[model samples]
Target: MLDFYTNPMSRGQTVRWMLEEVGADYQERLMNWGPSMKGTDYKKINPMGKVPAIVHEGRVVTECAAICAYLADAFPDAKLAPPPAARHDYYRWLFFAAGPLEQAVTAKSFGWTPTKEQSGVAGFGTYDLVVETMEGLLLSRAYVCGDAFTAADVYFGAQVLWGTRFGSLPSLHAFTDYAERLKGRPAYQKAKARDDALIAEGQAST
Candidate 1:
């Protein structure tokens, strides 16, 4: 069985949704933000002391995007990944969401808006460009790679969903419509319900 280490309030929720998407039978090891996550035990699983790490068949995987890609590939029956010819867009948008998009959201949250000069040096260019680029991509297709929903959608959709919720990304029609379509997925609903319950349980324990 897969051992999933996570904290509901963290990026772990994204991995949880992916697990459900792939129909993986896994055990969840919920870690707390401070003591549980910072301890040596959890640290060994993810040296960064982050949640959303997974140990599957004795192999360890960390990072939300990596986990999503790994799970999709590991379970070929799920057909979450596209053919080699289509992999360019799949990998492209997945990392785009993980890298530039994440950076822009983090910078905005910390009120660290980058100047044009700084954007030139930054990997994401400018925050406006990041948002506009993402919007244009989604505007052109139902999914990142076109009409088909692949593992890339799991990562990109989660980013867009979180960005829209926290007001980091604009509530553009393209973003909102895509996010709504993602939410309609049964796996997403299941993951959300499970994580919501876990969050409530954690709060109660505190």
Candidate 2:
């Protein structure tokens, strides 16, 4: 069985949506922020003490993108990923969305502006480049890799949702259109509804 450790409010939701997409039989261990994660036992599972870690096939995988990729490979029957022949774009867009886009948006959200010289040397390029690159790819097709939906979409779509939520990325017509399309998916709807309800409950208790 696949073991997934996560907090519903975090990036862990991305992996949860992927698991739902893959229709994998798995178990979820929810870690609520403070005490559960700080314990030594949890640290052994994920030293970073981050949510969205997974243990599968005797290997522990951390990070949302990595877990998504690993699940695609682990459950070949789900066909959540492209075949080996079509893997170039698959890996390219996956890591691209995971790294540059996520980093750049997060930095912008926090109001951090790197120096001109520093920006050129940084890993995420510039904010404009990040937005333009994503806009170009998304404006071209319904999904990232042409017509079919893949695991890359899971990561990319999540990043887009988060970026838009935090007001980091532009809420362009194309982005709004795409997000609507993604939300139409049953898995996305299910995961989001559950998380929303959980948040509501937490707020009520407090």
Candidate 3:
């Protein structure tokens, strides 16, 4: 069985969305910040003492990108990842989001844009370059791997949605339009409602 360890306000929300998308039967173990997440017991699940860790069939998976990819492959019936033979764009965009896209937006969050010389050494080049590149790709296609939605959307789209909402990313038409499409999905709504309720419950208790 799949055992998911996460906090509602964390990146785990994306994994939860993937879980719903796959229609997997999993047990959720909610955790809080500080000692609840950093204690020895939880550390065994993730040495980093982080949320968004999963154990399936006794194999542990951490990191949002890896977890999303693993779930897609583990439940092949979900069709979240394209078949091995047809995954050039799938793999490309997935890792691209995990690496350059993440770095670019994070750097922007801190108000750091690499200069021309510095950009050569920065993994994401520049935030504008990353943003323009992604905007171009979305304009050319419906989803990361093209017309059909995939697990790539869960990870990458979450970044776009969160980034746009929190001002880390510009409210470009491509991003807002794509986020609206993802928000309309039944699985996305179910996962979001669960996390939203969790957040509200924690707030009420505090």
Candidate 4:
């Protein structure tokens, strides 16, 4: 069984959603921020002191996209990922969403506008470029890699959902339609509902 270390409100939600998608049997070890993550204990799992780390077969997997991709490949029966033949696009968009989209959206959200000189040196290039590129690609397909729903969609779809919700990306027909399509997935809804309930409980307790 996989050991999942997570916080209800962190990027761990991405892993949680992917675990549901792959239908993997997993154990959840919830960790609180600060002490639980910062102290000596959790640092043994992830030196970065981040949530959403998973232990599978005694190996630790960090990063939300990597964790999701790893599980999709590990559990071939789930069919969450494409076969080795279709790996090119599968790997392509997965990293694209993680590297470019994640950094771009985060920088933009925090009002960290970069100048042309700074953009060249930064990882995301520019927020406008990232948003336009994403809009162009998603507009051309029902999902990132194509029509089929793969683990890539789980990452890209979540980004779209976040971008749309936070007013970071344009609420174009492409984004809206893509979100509407993902809305019908039972796993997505189940994962989201579970996390939302936990978040509500945490808030009430505080």
Give lDDT for model 4. 0.87
Model 3 error, position 166 (Å) = 1.3
- Tens digit of lDDT per residue, candidate 4, span 141-191? 888878889998888888888778778777988898998898788888888
Q: Which 10-residue window in model 3 sums to the lowest lDDT?
A: 105-114
**lDDT winner, 1 or 4:** 1
Candidate 3 lDDT tens digits, 1-206? 99999999999999999999999999999998989899999999999999899999999999999999999999999999998999898889889999999999888878887888999999899999999999999999889999999999999999999998998889999999999999999999999999999999999998
* TM-score for predicted model 4 compared with the true structure: 0.94
lDDT of 2 at 1: 72
Candidate 4 lDDT score at position 197: 89
TM-score of each: 0.97, 0.95, 0.98, 0.94
Provide the overall lDDT of each model, using Cα atoms, as 2-decimal numbers. 0.93, 0.86, 0.94, 0.87
User: For residues 87-206, what per-residue lDDT tens digits would candidate 1 score against the true structure?
Assistant: 999999999999999998888889998897898899988789999999999899999999999999999999999888989899999999999999999999999999999989978998
- As for candidate 2, its clashing pairs are none
Candidate 1, after superposition: displacement of residue 146 in Å? 0.6
For model 2, what is the error of residue 118's alpha carbon versus the real structure, in angstroms, after optimal superposition?
Answer: 1.5
